[model samples]
Target: MIDYQLDADGLATLTWNVADRPMNVLNQASIAAFTKAVERAISDPSVKGVIVTSSRPEFVAGGDLDLIRNIRDVAQSMDCSGPVSRILRRLETSKKPFVAAVNGSALGGGLEICLACHYRIVADDPNIQLGLPEVTIGLLPAAGGTQRLPRMIGIKKALPYLLEGRKADPAKAFEAGIVDAVVPSSELLSRARAWLLSAPAEAAIKPWDRKDFRFPGGSPQSPGPIQIFFGASGALLAKTQGNYPAQEAILACVYDGCQVDIDSGLKIEQRQFARLAISQSTKNMIRVLFYDMNDANRLAGRPKDVPKRSFKKVAILGAGMMGAGLAHVASTAGLEVVLLDVSGDAAEKGKAYGAAILEGQVARGRIDESVRDATLGRVIPTTNYSDLADCDLVIEAVFEDRAIKAEVTRKAEAAMRVDAIFASNTSTLPIGGLATVSKRPARFVGMHFFSPAEKMPLVEIIRGAGTSEETIAEALDFARRIRKTPIVVNDCPSFYANRAFAMYPYEAMTMLAEGVNPNLIENAGRKAGMPMPPLALIDEVSVELLYKAMKQARADQGSSYCAQPQDAVLIAMVEQFGRLGRKAGRGFYDYPSDGERKLWTGLTEHFPRAEKQPSVEEVHERLMYSQSLEAARCVGEGIVSVRDADIGSLLGWGFPSFLGGVLGQIDTVGLPQMITVCDRLAQHMPERYAVPQILRDMAASGRTFH
Candidate 1:
């Protein structure tokens, strides 16, 4: 995998190109080959210095997660990280200068390898990212990242990249001193060779290994670093709520390791990595977030017989936030978008949304002005249905009303190609029911994009009863085209994500109706690792909207509908009181124009706090079990698969990555224990807490979701 070449000038070049893999990863086999190549260069009298580069598009993708996933103990974790760490350390101190010519994105172990070199240079490609982002996947950088990065930059400057797993492009990386230089792709290798050829013997030795070397800013004990560490620890606790051990472990590694020599610091990093690597949470995260998520993105469940589809031009019906956001993503993906609305002005306004977002990206230096203009130019806003005549796909993102959706569906189909797919961006409405209005029901499917569609990572592809395999494939293709993770689910009310996620807010409101303190309810949700507390989440989504959805469901299902305990609170917030939501500047919490939002003082008058309140642990369990149980029901009902359920839960909503999504949470809580807890909880709310038969069967068979 490592191709070694030597020039007459005594400069060795090692190019990494792993066979059968898209990107080079640090695994046992690859690491062994790399070590052999490095050793050869170090021992050869003809070799004076070395340049490390990649033949693949990306320098390296990081460690082989498959290898890391199987690590079950501390020894195994050490075995996985130790050899690579030692090899990198040896390369830096071999008395021969080494330079990393990074051609593309280098992350985690990849960036660690770059740090080991005497000098680092990268291609000036906007897509080339450099960072140690191991904490995001529930592990720290075990191969000398935590130590070398802080030393290369400083404690203050490096903490964000290390702890938060933030990545930077070539310019930002060069500015932050993560890279020594940024050059054109053509000059990458030549520049590395030039630097290595001119370097003195002292350049081979790292600053940390020198006798008189001082830290870039100050040592770990200095007042500035101490304050930064304290603030970082507190911020990490507040953000992660102590659920993610990787962040805490990373902090400890940087704090403790920076105080010692480089060798000792590497050992400290390895130990911290081992502790996190062997933990169940880490394993769960790697399994779901990495493997399962990759599977979904690859459309693993797509019908085998159907050929893949590619969308060229897409027409979006309506110019609201969802429609505009869809237009932005479609245009960005190089598809011509026809943004249609009832009025010409309304359509223009929708197109402006994409322009505003692109402008912001340009202002932030995320994209070039030329790229922004090109993307904006792809969107054609108008009121004419004829604009959609040549579109390959047409999605109706109009209001969530049957009549309005039916009107747009009929109109768009009339002007579109006979084989072109039609979809609805519905969050709760059933695609099967909506398909009744379509002339070609087989082509009708649900492409449910979450709010601010361009940003959300997930696109729930709902398959209607009549949706053809080809249509499903097309929807999956479109979702993939926009680089969004696609999870296929059978059509039902709320499909999968909304059905399972609704339980979170409902449970919180039920607690409020039971006289539980609002603050305690909100805290329970946050401590459970949810992105937003239930009350605040509902306010953002709007209490009036929830009330309307509840009313519609009650009307549709008639006597079959089961009223939730939260229904009374929803009605009180919307009708009895004038509290609509955040839009109305009042709801469960007041949204002042000048200050942070807090719970409405009048909440106590309507729902008095109980003399004896539920424990925070109890509240946390209730909220978690409620949502997870619903997710299990979705799996049992065949609405979604176990993998999709987990992936959807994590990406669709902000289900904590550390918990490994909803079903993974159940597996984490052993099935037997989960069922027992559900039985206990069933006494309070039997209908809501009822355990699905799938969990009981899995428990009986001693099976886990993974």
Candidate 2:
């Protein structure tokens, strides 16, 4: 894993090249090898100095997160980081000068290793990123990162990278004082060698090791530290609402670690790292964000017998916002797209939307003009059905009406080739019903793209009863091609995401009608870590549209539909008050052409205020418990698996990441406690808050969702 070589110039090179792995990660075996290499370089008669570099395109990713995840307890977690910390400490204190030649991404423990060297010279590659991003995975950097970074860049300046997990390219890293020099990729080694040969022996001792050295931003009692630490504490509480322990732990590491000597500081960071590594929050985040997300991306559990497929051409049958956005994203991903509509003019209008978005990208310097032109040129717009002749797939993003969808399916299928698949982007309609018009029922699937398809990261793939495994695999592959995360679900009205998501707004509206202050309701949603307050989200999705969905559900589900109680709130806002939504500049809140919006003060007139109201905690519980209960019901009914339910709740509806996802929330707040809360709420709203039998059994058994 560590190759040690001494040249005629007395400069030793330690190249990291872990066998059988694409990228080198600092694990127990590699750290032990590195320690031996360091001792050899220090004692060898022929070696005068050392140069640390990589044998691959990138240096290292970070410490082995898999190892961190497998830790049985705090002692094991400490053991995981303790070795690397000691190795880095010995290298930094060695009398012989050491320089790092960073080739590519040096994140987390990777950058921590570089910080221990006397000097760092990076290749001038735009793709090379450098930073300590341990906090993103819910741990502070344990290998002297907290102590070394602030000593080099000052505490105030280093806070952003530590807090936000920000990384920078070579130029930015140099500007941020993370690296000593930037050179051409070809000259990186030569530059490191030259620095080692020319620099005095005293350069081996870091500034932090000097007895007379003062901290860059002054001591912890200085004005900058006082303001940044206190101000950031308040901001963090407001942003996270104390839901994430990692953020606060990071703050604690920096504040306390910077107050002592370098070695003591590293010890402080190590203990904190162990504490957070074993935390349930960190464990939940790793399982969902890393393990589950990676599994979904690879299409795990897909039929192994099915052959791999690639999508080359696609046809979108509509010219509205959803269709146009799909065309833009498809073309951007190097696929030929045929955008169709009722007429040539309408189709051209849809094409123009993509052009406008690319032009905006050009204005922001994200892409050059030539690239924009090339991307837009791949989209062919026309009204004729013949344009879809050679297409591999056709997605019908027409209006959400069963009759309209069935009509489009029949028309588009006639133009599609024999092997082509048909997909529907219906938000609420079932895929099995829409597939009735397809001649090859097994080839039909649902690829439900969220609104503004070009930007949303998630695409919910729904499989009807008759859909073939081949078709499902192809749909998932296509979703990957478009750079969208997918979670497979079985066909149902609203499928998984939308079915559970509707409960969020319904509960919010119920609160509104019961005379809870609109402002309080909105604040509670934000404090609960929802991306948007339920009312604000309703306005963006359109109050009129939600009312129509509710009406449709009532007609289809009969008088016993659970959302009926929330209908009065939607009716008064859309019909009686003439407040359609944000598009109409009025709803539960007023959206003006200019300036900020506030709650429409007239809401109390239609729905009178009550003599007493529920606490903010009660309102928050209603919002979260309602959606989570529905998610569990979806899981119990087999509409979605346990992992997919959590994935959908997170990417589809913006469920808070700190809670992991809907199912994760059950684990965060113990299952039995969630059951108790659900029982209390069910006393008044049993239809929405009643716990599923599966949840009750799990609570009784003391089992978690994981």
Output the lDDT of residue 535, model 2.
92
Global Cα RMSD, each model: 1.5, 2.1
Question: Per-residue CA lDDT of candidate 2, range 539-598, in tens?
Answer: 889999998887888877896776567899888887788888899899888877787987
RMSD in angstroms between candidate 1 and the native structure over all alpha carbons: 1.5
Question: At residue 526, what lDDT does model 2 achieve?
Answer: 92
lDDT of 1 by residue, 151-222 (tens): 989999999998889999999999999999999999998899889888988999999888998888899999
Counting only residues 3 or more apart in sequence or on different chains, how many pairs clash (N, Cα, C under 3 Å) in candidate 1?
Answer: 0
The model with the greatest lDDT is 1
* Overall local distance difference test of candidate 2: 0.88
The TM-score of candidate 1 is 0.98
TM-score of 2: 0.95
Off by over 4 Å in 1: none
